[model samples]
Target: MGGSRHVATSSTHPGDLHIPGSHRFYCTAPCLSWRGGVGMRGSVPPPLIPVSPSSLLQPEPLLLAPSGTSRPAGSHRALRGSLERESFKPSSQPEEPKHNRRQPSPCPRSVVEAAKAHPTFGELFQFATPVLMWDQHFSPETWNRLKERHVPYGWQGLSHAAVSSTLRLLNASANRHLFDRRRFPGGCVRCAVVGNGGILNGSRQGEAIDAHDLVFRLNGAVIRGFEEDVGTKISFYGFTVNTMKNSLIAYEEYGFTQIPQAEDLKYIFIPSDVRDYIMLRSAIQGSPVPEGSDKGDEPRKYFGPEASAEKFKLLHPDFLHYLTARFLRSELLNMQYGHLYMPSTGALMLLTALHTCDQVSAYGFITANYEQFSDHYYEVEKKPLVFYANHDMLLEAELWRSLHQAGIMELYQRFQLENALHSAITPQPKRLAPGQDKWEESLAWRRNGLN
Candidate 1:
């Protein structure tokens, strides 16, 4: 009767017992097995039961619900506990072994030796007793000197904080391959400074221009359809922020929809205003131009998406001051438009190349016979070149001629053609009233955006 009663109870609660030759039933609560063991239903053959206090304190076995059935409230807590245990468990897999990474290739030994052997003007200046450094980095003393001596016209008043921030940001940018020895392995870097002057219109000097180790081009350098005359190679492009923006605005019709973006090409930023520093910082950071007259301006729109810190070079204000004090100072310094006067982009590039390269050849630059040709080589019509108070063309022309005579640089000269053309087109000087030489008219025209 007792055995029959146990069988009846097991039959009533099938989950408490494992029925032979049938699928097992799982239990939500602890159940007594047929052999007096305590465990979840359908685990395995019945085992011996534990009666110690330690056994009672042990955690309960996790309960899993059958398919299509709901789990009990305690089952949820068990699931969470199981997951926590799994998360805290140590991983058995080993970590990857780290290896030493290779460094970038250094500059060629020969070029380094050559740089040491032939001290450049910049190096000599730096070594002088009263030293004057000429690199892009500026000290506070140098910045103060530049502020006093050099005035960038379009900028707001100069401030130490602003200038310091610009320098700090620039210094934080990736280092450039400045005159890389690997690129100039022969230790004699020849450079071509190509200006946009119309002298290059029929010069047929493309092959000669491309042969140089580096080529510096500035302003409206339209070379797509006119590659035969201007050459396809451009190593460095130099421009002020004002000039670059103006060039894009003014010369979009002449195939200059974008600036040069060759993989190996670099940009030299002429710091003509605080906007330049702002733009440069934004460009390096790959962000929109922050707080300034050029707020919300996208630098990638001008310098392309791949533009990087290493690809942009800023000219130090002190360097500009040194260049002005040494080579390209104009008499306009004393005039009312003195603040507006600076060397043209071409003059700056040519002088920079002269100081950096072993040999430099200038092309399409203003000559004494500039009146014979159009204002720009890409001009479809032979428009007469207009003179402005901002640049001293006459002074630049004399300097070029003198530099050529001294053999410091090879300035492309077509004297016979220039002389003949000048003689044929020379006009009688229009007599102006005393102390009136069309300066005011030019200034007014420039102010009205006619330049």
Candidate 2:
């Protein structure tokens, strides 16, 4: 069952960011890495005034029906969760949003600027490109051609209002990039992108991972008992609503009862579908998912009451569109079932880090010898990695291999199982991550009605 909103009609919670049923608001983030249906499609449209507060589906009216009704087996829901675009709740102060951009401890100048473009597209992986979509990106021509076409990536089968309302709020407080450059010491930042692959099960790479200025983690990120292996600091989390919920339901026993929440953490919403927009909006608004695949979902449950506009970011569809086309292109797309493919969530997060951070280190991602380890580092029992059709793990592995060899990023890979197991038994220095105090454990795990 989906979590229901809880609050008192009286809005007198002195320090609380909001009272769910009350007219208050806040913002937050999370993501998952398991092989499941991950929708990845979007564009680099600019932000504009939302079409109309009354119709998130304006300019293009579509049918609306509750998914819970006696609808046909496969009839698509007109009122998608994200597409049910509603204007953001007016904040009492209505002040300009100040995002919680992570400023890691000052370090030497370190920014990623590849000297030459990879031969793949004759373009250096656009490291510092804009990532979030806004009003201007939603041009009429692009919508006319791609709204329902389902081509390169997301933004298909959605109405103008739905997309517009969502983008409008994104520009409300979020920045187009992952972090603020000025926050770093020398305009250089180091980051670690952590995946759940079993390579880190006992690798004891925690000290190395927590050493970076910022860290990105995703998909079944079970951190409690394995802090010695995965570290306790999480600067960013990337995931679609589908994966977040599915991970919660599927991995609850693994101890991932809640997504990591802290003052410094930010969420990167991959607009894989309109549903992502809906969840992102609700998360920003601190209310229930107004409509769509996740109707009645309480963003407050997963994010906590302090959900702020500055805490969230929506991945520009253009980024994904460019990524799949240039870097992670796979032959799977050529097969009859190829259209279902896009980069995995881990790939998206890793690449995002590669583009945004000066130095990138990947931990627990799939390596060439994936069969030697269990599916995920946090798994209770050994299970082979599942190759779902939606992603081509081999292609991603090769891309990482090439990039690692090219001196672009560090991929935590080793050919021998004995060496990996040695990491756990070996003695290593214990150290605290810089600014770890900002990411103290959240108390939301005790709350209820989490969808």
Candidate 3:
């Protein structure tokens, strides 16, 4: 009689309570809170019937049998009305963008310049002689057996098929570095792998030269007043014995009396002759230059004790296959190079850089309007981009354009970037030496497909 609670009927209102079959107990004060444990001692009452609004109010004490089972101290299911109304569902996740790829560490201008003061083994390895090989891929055994193992990492002992696939991936990844694709967040890093082409002289790209992250030059490419057209920075310089000599002799009038001096510019040697190998080996051992009749006077000075020839990086053979398989199609490969067989030197240099640099932007290369410039920057006359028996220029151009379209490279057009760098202008007829004319004739014959 002291404290028994009862509910009479069930109602939709929050304050109205029900206890089924007992006497009516209308809740008129406020909402009620059920707390503490309720023991299940007696049976529950019958189901309650809802009262209509017209029914009269009753105040009878309803019997409230503690029907709730007593759960263990921590095992109670405490369900709040507010919590029960909220629906639970998993949320959708966002997709990551493709541009989030590997990033290369940026080498600052100051650091790059600082590296120039000390000439490493690369600088000392002055001789670049071309090493020619047939289409036959080298076996892993063959590479391991070589006197000096020059293959890049991860390329040793791979089967031809495996090597083919791996190089394809590498080439694909490298091509991604050549453009402004979403795969490369760093945007395009244009590199002008400038050859000693006389064609660049009157092309009018002097002042409007393309802006790129790096520039590679070879041999005797003199960029004095044409700095605007060719940019002032010399990032990478490549050389071979014959090519470097040719550059010096050919471009001497183009302000190339001495090699372009840069604090951080790297000198890359292209081995094209057997003598170059001997000279380099001697230089590495700090020995005197070999005694050959053709050897220059006082060759010992070229390979002094300070020379470090072994540090120079050589191109991996797999890299050549990667290039040949992708760009140099079979038809172009069969294109002969005079009495000997080889790809264009400029093409080879640029291709090597494509694989080496993390990002590449090309400037001062042949374009659709290649007819607009002299054969070389220091040319006395405007010369057509003459095809030679020594190399295939048209095929190279086609490859460049294809790579550009595939987002693999950036080719600076002759007229497009003229105002960006220092350049010169002239109009002259095409000319060639007596011995070189034969090469042009052979080039024309190849163009006509004589064989």
Give the per-residue lDDT digits (tens) of candidate 3, residues 1-451: 2345544322211222345433322221111222121211222333322211110001111111122322223211121111221211111111112342333425332212222232221121111111222123245553453313122212333344433322232222222232233533564344557765654555565444445556677666677776655656676666654455444444556676665554445445444443333344454445654543224423235323353432233344434333333333222122121112234556777876554444445555665556656656655656544443223455566556545544445566544355324335544222222222222222233233222
Which runs in model 3 stand beyond 4 Å of their true positions? 1-140, 143-190, 202-211, 261-263, 282-287, 291-311, 329-339, 415-451
Model 1 Cα shift for residue 406 (angstroms): 0.8
For TM-score, the strongest prediction is: 2
- Pairing residues by index, what is the TM-score of model 2? 0.67
Stretches of model 1 off by over 4 angstroms after superposition? 1-150, 153-156, 172-177, 415-451
For candidate 3, which ten residues in a row score worst on lDDT? 52-61
Q: Model 1 clash pairs?
A: none
Over 351-388, each residue of candidate 2 has an lDDT whose tens digit, in order, gives: 88876787889999887677678878887788766454
TM-score quality measure for candidate 3: 0.48
| TM-score for each candidate, following the candidate numbering | 0.62, 0.67, 0.48
**If ranked by lDDT, best first, what sequence of candidates would result?**
2, 1, 3
Q: What are the lDDT figures for the candidates, one per model?
A: 0.55, 0.59, 0.39
- The order by descending TM-score is 2, 1, 3
Error of 3 at 73 (Å): 98
* Candidate 2 residue runs with Cα over 4 Å from true position: 1-111, 114-124, 139-152, 417-451
Assess candidate 1 and give its TM-score to the true structure. Answer: 0.62
